[model samples]
Target chain A: MNIEQINIKKSIQIYDELTKGRIINRHIYSSSTHSLIDNPLFQELRENLDIYTNQYQMSGHELIDDGEYFYLIYKKLESSTNQLIKTKVYSAIIVLVRCVTHLQARLYESIKNVNYGIEIKEINEIELPEEYLLILEKAKLGTLDKAVEYLADRSFLIKTNRDKYVLSNAGLSIVDEIVERQNG
Target chain B: MINYKSTIKYIVDYDEPFASLVEYMDQHSVTRVPVVFFELQVKQLIDKITKGTDRQIIDAISKAYALRNLKQHNFVTHDESNESIALTKFIEMFVRNMSEKMRVKPITDKRFKAHASQLTNILNEANSYVSKTTNDKANFREYLQDFLSEVKQDFESNKRAITLRTDNLSKLLKSSEAHGDQRLIYTKIVELCERYVEPFFQFISHTQDKNGFIPTMVRLREFFAEQEMLDEEAEVGRFILNFSSYTKDIQHVYDRINDYRRKGQQDLIVFNGFEKAFNHLSEIVMGMQDGLLVRNDLHNNQDFIESYKRFDNIKADNEKHGNVSINYTDLIEHFKNIEKDLVFSSRRSSQNSPLTQEINLERLALDKESASLLRARNQKNKQLILKISKLIKLHFSSFTKLEEPMDIIGDIHKILSAHMDDYRPFFTLYAYTNIRKKLLAIEKQGRIRVCVGYDQRKTFAYNGISYKYRPILIQDLT
Candidate 1:
C-alpha cells in the first residue's frame, strides 16, 4: 500500500494531540476521536507511525505510539513540561499503582477500562515489599495521600474520595508499560 | 516491507538458537561479527514457515513473540512432560496440545466483563497473533524479535513518554535535598531493583531449563511488596470504636426508660420526649441484636430480686387501685428489643468523640467515683441490665398466686440465696446487682410501690437450720 493511501485527515488529528504533549488515549477522547480511531486511516498511521510521524517531526520532535497511547517525546529533553512528574516519591506511587494494575490485568483480559475503587484506609493492603512500608510509617508529606494527589492531578488515578481511588486509563497504561518492562 | 533483517538481528541477539550462537561466539572468543549467521538463521526460519511468502513472515513472527512470553512465563501446556521423539513430531504435538489449552473457556465467570473497545480490539488481535505462535516454535522466534525489539526499545529509551512527565511533579516537591530521609528510601529501592531484580533473568531466554534458575516473578514481586512496603488494605486499623458507641446509646435509652411509668407503658401516652427517645432506643436495640450472642455476658442478682418482688407489689396494689394492670408482654419485648440493639451495633463509637483522657490526679479519682454511672458504656463488669428486666417478668408471668410481693421474692431468694449450704449454692447473681434507679423510676411513676421491708433481713431454712439476708416484699396500691 502506498503511503499516500493513508488518510491524511485522521493522522493530522492524532498528530495534533501527540505534538501538544497530550496522551491520545481513545477512551478519554470525544466520540469523533474514537470514531476516527476505528477508521482505516488510524490503523495505517498506527502500523507505519515512524513514516508519518518522522515526516511531520522534521521540526526536530518525535512521534511514538505505545500499544494503547500515542504521544510525543521531545529529543531536546525540556527541563520541565506541564505534565512532567518531578519527584521520585511520586514515581514510587505510580509504580505501586502500576504493580497492582498488572496483577489484576493477568486475572482479567479486558481489565484496563474497569475501575475498582481502592479505599485509602486499605493502602497498606497492596502487598508491597517490607522495606518500603517502614519508610511510609515515618513520612508526613510523602504518604500515599501525597502520591495519590500527584497522580490524580495528572489523570493517572481518580480520587473518588479522601479514602478511595479508581484507576483511570492513563493509570492502567502506565501499569501496562511498567509490567512489560519489569517482566521483559 | 517490514524491517525483518535488523529485527531478526535484535531477536537473535536475545532469543534462542541465535542467542545461543552469539553466546557461543563470545565464549569461544570469536572476534568477527556473526551478523551473517544471524541473518541466515532468520531467513531460514521465515522461508521454512511462510513457504517463501515473505509478508506472511510478520504473522509468523507475531506468534513467535507470544510463544516466547509463554515460554518465559513457563506456562505449562500438559500436566506431564511428553518426551520428544523427533523435532517435527514434538512441534506438531505441542501445537495441538497448546491450541486445546488456549481454547478452554476462561474459568471465572464475571458478571460484567470490561467492554472490548477499538483499542482493546487491536490488543486482542495482537494477542491472537501471539497465541497462534504456540506451534511456531521452530519458525516463531526468528524474525519476531523485530516486534519485541521495537516494543522493548521504545519502553527502554522513551520511558518518559509512557510515564508521568517529571516537571509537573517537581513543582510540588521541596526537592530530594530538602527531604533527605525520603530521598534515601527512594534511592535504596531504585538502586536495589536495578542491581538485583532487573538483571536477575536477563539471559534466561537462552536456557532450555529455567525452572531451577529463574525464581518465579510472583515470589520476587511478593518480596518487593514487603520490601517496598505498599500500603495493603488488610493492614488498616480501627474502622469504628465498638465499645464507647454502644454504651453511649444504651445509657441514653436507660435514662429515657427510667422516666416511664412501668418502665415505659405510662409514658407511652403521657410523655412528650417519650416517642422520639423510645424509637431511637428501639433502633439501637435493633442494631445490637446481630452481635448479642458473641459479646461477654455481664449481670448481677440484686436488680433481678428487686424487679421481681416489685412485680408482685404492683399486682397487689392494682387490686385496690382499680384494674390498671401493666402489660407484661410489651415490657418483656422491649427488654429483648433493647438487648438486641445494644449487642448488634457493637462497633459504633463516634470517630470524633472517643473517651477523653482525665486531666489531673483529682479528675482521675472523680472519674473512678462516677465510673458506675457509665458502667454500661465503659463495658466494665460485662453485666447487662436487660436480662434482669426480662427475668423479673418471666418469673412472675408463670405464678398463679403472686397476689403479694412477699410471695415472689421468697421463691427467688429460697432457690438462690438461702442455699449457701445446699448441694449447689446458686447466688452467682449476687456479685453485682443494680436496681436502685429502676426501682426509683417505678416508684416515681406512682403506680408501683417498691417499699423496703421493715426487717431489712429475713431468715430461711438451709442445712437443716436457718440462713439470713435481706427479704424484701412488694405491696400494690389499694
Candidate 2:
C-alpha cells in the first residue's frame, strides 16, 4: 500500500506518538490526545499495517498492533531500554498476581473487563510477600502509586478513576505472553 | 388472680434485660437460666437506675418471681432444681418469632420420610371416612384440615431452613475470611452439597422418582381436588386453593435452591482456578528464590561480571544478524541479569561502575565451574525426562494390551518407583504433556481415541510444590 493513500499529516502524528514510546490504546486519552483506535488514521493503518511497520522500522522500532492497541518496541534493545522493559514486566506480574490471589479475580476477566477494574486502595491493602516486596523495590515500583503512575505513563493501565485502573490491551498482551509461558 | 396488665407493664419496663436473657437462652439452646445469673443481670440493671441497696435488689427479685407466677404472663416457670428460671412456652415462642437469627434446623432424610408416611396415613383415613355418616364426614373434614395445617407449617419451616442455610453458605463462600482458608470453604461447600442441597434436590425431584416430596404434594392436591368435585363443599375448595398457593411457594423455593446451586458450582470453579494459579505462581517464586540463593552462594561479583561479559558477547553476535525480536524467555533472562547486577552492585560502592571493576583470578575460575554445574543440571533434567517418557510408553503399551483405561499419574508413579530411584512430579508432568501431545497427533487419524478426564484431577507433590492435572485415557481402536 502507498503511504500517500492515507492522510499524511494524521499518519505522521500517530508515528510521532509511537516513536515517543506511548501505546495508543482504544481508551480515550486526556483532552490533548484522541483515542487512535477510533481515529480514521487507525483504520488506514490497519488497512496498510505493513506500510506503518516499514515506516516505524526505519526508526529502529517495530510497530506492534495487538488488535485493540498499537505500540512500538526497540528492534535493537539498549541496556537502559532493557532495564525499563524488565521493570515494567516485573511490576505487571506483581500487580496482576496480587489482583488474582488477593482480590479473587480471574486473570483474563481482570484484564479484559472494565467492571473488574482494580481499585488502587485494595491492591495497596494486599500484604505482599517479603520476596515480592524486594523485587518491587528493586524495580522502583515499591509503592502501588508509583507503579500505577509508571504503567499509566506507558499506557499499560488506563485510569478509570482517581483510585481505579483497568488493563489496556498492551498490558493484556504482556500478561498473555506470561500466561502462555506458564502454560508451556 | 394475678394482675395481667401490671405484669405486662413490668416486663415491658424491663424489656432490655428480658430481651438479653431471652437472646442468651436462644443462642445457647437452653430453656433455663440460673436464678443467680438472672438476678445478677437484673441487679446490674437496677443499679444503673439507682445506687440500689441489697433491699432494692431483693425487691426486684421478688417482683420477677411474682411475674413468673402470674398465669396470664406465663413468662417463666421454676424448674425442679428451683435454682434456675425456665422460660415458659409463650415467652420462648414469642422471642423466637421476634429474633432476627434464623437457626437452620436440618431435616434428615429419615425425618422427611416419616413426615411423608404420616401424610399418606392421613390421606388413607380421610378416604375411609368419605362415604360414612355426617359425623364421620365431619371427622374426615377435621382430619384433613389438621393435616393441611401441619403440612403447611412443615413447608414454611423447611423453606426457611433451606433458604437461610443456602444464604449463609453463599455469604461464607464470598467472604474474604473464607477466601484465606480454602480448606474450610471446601468443607463448607461439601457439607452444603451433601447434607442439604443433594437431599433437598432428591426430595423435590418428581421426574426421577415417583415418591419425592413434589409427587407426594401432587397426590395430596389431586385428593383435595377430587373431594372438592364430589362434595361441592366450600371447605374442600379452600383446601384446593391452599394447595395451589403451596405449589407457588414450593416453586419459589425451588428457583432459589437452583440459583444457589448454580452459584455454588461457579464459586467452586473460580476457587479451583484461583488455587491453581496461586500454587503455580508460588512454585515459580519459590524456584526463583532457590535459584537466586544457589547462584548467590556459588557465584561472586567477579563471576557475575564475567557472565555479563559473555552475555554481552552473545548480544553483540545477535546484533550482527540485524534486528532480533525479543521474546518472553529472553526478557526473563534480561531481568535476571538486572537482578544479579542489583544484588552485587549494592555490595560495591554506589559510585563504582561495572567497567571500572577489576576481575580476580579465583572468581574467574569459579565462573567456569558454575557454568559447568549448570550444564550438568540441565543434562540430568534431560535424562530424567527421557527415562520418565520411556517408562510412560512402556506402561501405555501394557495398558493397551490389557485394554484398560490408565490412571496416568498413579500408574506412572508405580512404574517410576519400580524402575528409577530419582522421581519428581515435575518431570512426570513434562513427560505426560509430551505423551499427550503425541497421542493427540495419532488420535487425529482413526487409529486411536484420546479422552481427557476433566472431572478427575490427579495431584502429586515434589519438593513441597504441588502439581495437579486431569487424567488422560487413550484407547487403541485399530
Candidate 3:
C-alpha cells in the first residue's frame, strides 16, 4: 500500500482507539479522581491532540486547564462529505511532500548546493506562517490543490501540472542567494 | 519557438535497436511515431520526441500519413513508438530534404519507464510517512529533501529571480535560530508542566511557606482581587466570622425577646444592635453564596458537604441557649435559596461591579508577566491535591508495569491518606480494602496484583474473589 494509505489507516486507528473511543463521563472526570488528567502521560496525549487537530480536518472535546495545558478527545467529523473526499487529498500531500523532498535531496547531492532540497524535518518544526498553517491544518489531503494555492501565494512552490510541482524560480533563487551569502 | 531536450544519456544502453527503428520511420516520412519497447503511455514518448519539430511538416505528416495508417491497419498503426523510428531514419538519410523543419528526437522507452517508476515511489513513500509519525522529526526532514528535488528538476532555472530578498533571508535565519533556541524548549516543558502537573496537586505547603492563606482562601482572594473588590473580601471574611459569632450572641438576645414577650416587658435586646447584627449575618451569608457559585461550577457532594458542615456548626453553637428562641431552620433555608437562584447564571455581570472591576484589570496586567510566585504556590497546591486524588483512585486498579508489587501497595496507601478529604469516605475505604487484598494476594500467590474493589470489607470479596491485604511501596511497583 501507498504511504498515504498507511497514514490514513494509522490516523483512523488513533482516532478510533485512544481518543474517540474513550467515553468521557463528566461526573468521573470532574471528581477528585479526575486528577488523572494531570498525569504527564495524559498531558502528552492532550498535546498530541492539539497537534493533530491543528493538522487534520478533525475536532473533539478539548478541556483546557486555565490555558496551561489541554485535554482533547477528537471525533472525526463523520457527517462531512468534504472530509470523505479529503481523505484522498490528505494522502496526496504525504505523497507530494515525500516526492519533492526526495527529489530535492538528490538534486542537492548532485550540485553540491545546499539550497536545493527541502528540510523536511525542519519544515515540520518550522511553524508554518500562521496564515499558511491554518490553511494546512484545516485542509484534507484531497484539497491539496488548495494547499498548493496557499503555497503559491506565499511563493513557497507552485504546481506545474496535475500532481506535479516545482519550486518557483523566485523560491529557488531565495535559497540560492542565501547559500551564496552564507558561503562568502 | 522553444527548444526542449530529453535527458536521454541513460537510454544508450538500449540505443542500437532504437537507432535502427528511427532510421526506418524517417525513410517512410512517418511522423507522430510510437515507440512500443515498453507497454506504457506511448503518447508521452511521442510528445518528448517531437517537442521542437517543425509544425507544418509534422502537421501534414500527422494528417495524411497518421490518418491513412489508422484506416488501413489496426496493428496499433500510427503508434508513435513504431513510426518515430521510421521518421528518425528518414531524417538522417536526407538531412537537406527537410531544411528549417521541426526535428523529432526519440527517447528510449526503457529509460522513460525507469525514471517514472522511481519518481512514483519517491512521492508515494514520503506521502505515507508524514501522516503516521507526528513526533519523528527525522523522517519529516528526509521527506522535505525529497520534495525539494522534485521541484528543482521540474522548474526552469532563473539565476536572478531565485535569489532570496534580504527580508525573507532574515526571516529564514530568524526561524532557524528560533527552532534551536533552548528557551523555546524550556517554555514548552514549563507549559507542559503547568498544563499537566500543576492542576492535580495542591501546593498547600508552599502557601504556608510563602503566604499565610490556605489554598481555598488564596483562590477566594484571587477571585475577589480580579473583581477589584478587595474591600468586599475583608468585609466578607468579617461578615462570615460575625455570623459565626452572632449564632452564639443571637441566642442570648433571642431569649431576652422571648422572655420579654412572656412577661410583656418593654425594654428588650430585640430592638437595636441585636436585630441589626442578626439581619447582617443573613445578608453576608447570601452574598457569600453568590460569590462561591461564581468562582466554581461545583454543585456535587463536596459542595454539599462544605455547606452542610458550616451551617450545622453555626446552628449547634447558637443552640447552647436552652430557650432556642430564634428559628435556625429559617436561616438555613435562606442560604439554600441563594444557591438555587444562582445555580447556572453566568458571572460576567459581576465584572461590572466596582469590587470586581479593578481586580479584573489587575489580573489582566499580571497575565502579561512571565511568572508569579503566588501563582506558583497556588498551582503547587492544585497539583498536590490532584496527585493525591489520583493515587487514591489508582489504588483500586491492578499494577501492570511494576516489577515488585509489595512496595507499590504501601506507597499508594500513603498517597491516599496524605490528600484524603474527610468527605470522600468511600474512596478511602475502597482504597484501604484494595491495598490490603493485593498485599495478601501477593504473599499467597508468590506474585503481586493490584486489584480493584468495591467495598464489601467483611467478605473481603473484590471482583468476586477474596485476597489477603498488605501495603505496597513505590519502589516495588517501578
Best by DockQ: 2
The list of candidate 1 runs beyond 4 A from truth reads A1-16, A26-52, A78-95, A98-184, B1-478
Superior candidate under lDDT, 2 versus 3: 2
lDDT of 3 at B242: 37
Worst ten in a row by lDDT for model 2 chain B: B308-317
Model 2, span B1-478: residue lDDT tens: 3356655565555554556677777579786777777767776776675654466544654475453444346677766566777767566555454555635355555655666787677656656656789988877667766766665665566666666766676566567444445435555555655675556555554422576554555566567677664442444345445654545555665565566555444445444543444454444444445545433211122321231211121111122232233355766866665555566653453343333343465887999999999999999988877777777777775334436765666566556766888765555666666776667677787567777798888776556876677877766676
Positional deviation of residue A117's Cα in model 1 after best superposition, in angstroms: 4.1
Clashes of each: 50, 0, 89
Give the higher-TM-score candidate: 1 or 2.
Answer: 2
lDDT by residue (A8-95, candidate 2, tens digit) is 8878878766654567765543424422135454576688789889987896667777687776766665442233343444344545
A46-161 per-residue lDDT for model 1 (tens digits): 77776777665785555555555554555444321121122222244433443333322211112222333555455545565433333232221255555665455444554542
Give the CA lDDT, 0 to 100, for residue B93 in model 2. 51
TM (chain A), candidate 2 = 0.72
Ranked by lDDT, top first: 2, 1, 3
TM agreement with the true structure for every prediction: 0.20, 0.41, 0.17
Q: Is candidate 2 or candidate 3 better by DockQ?
A: 2
DockQ (model 2, Cα): 0.07
Better of 1 and 2 by lDDT: 2
Best by TM-score: 2
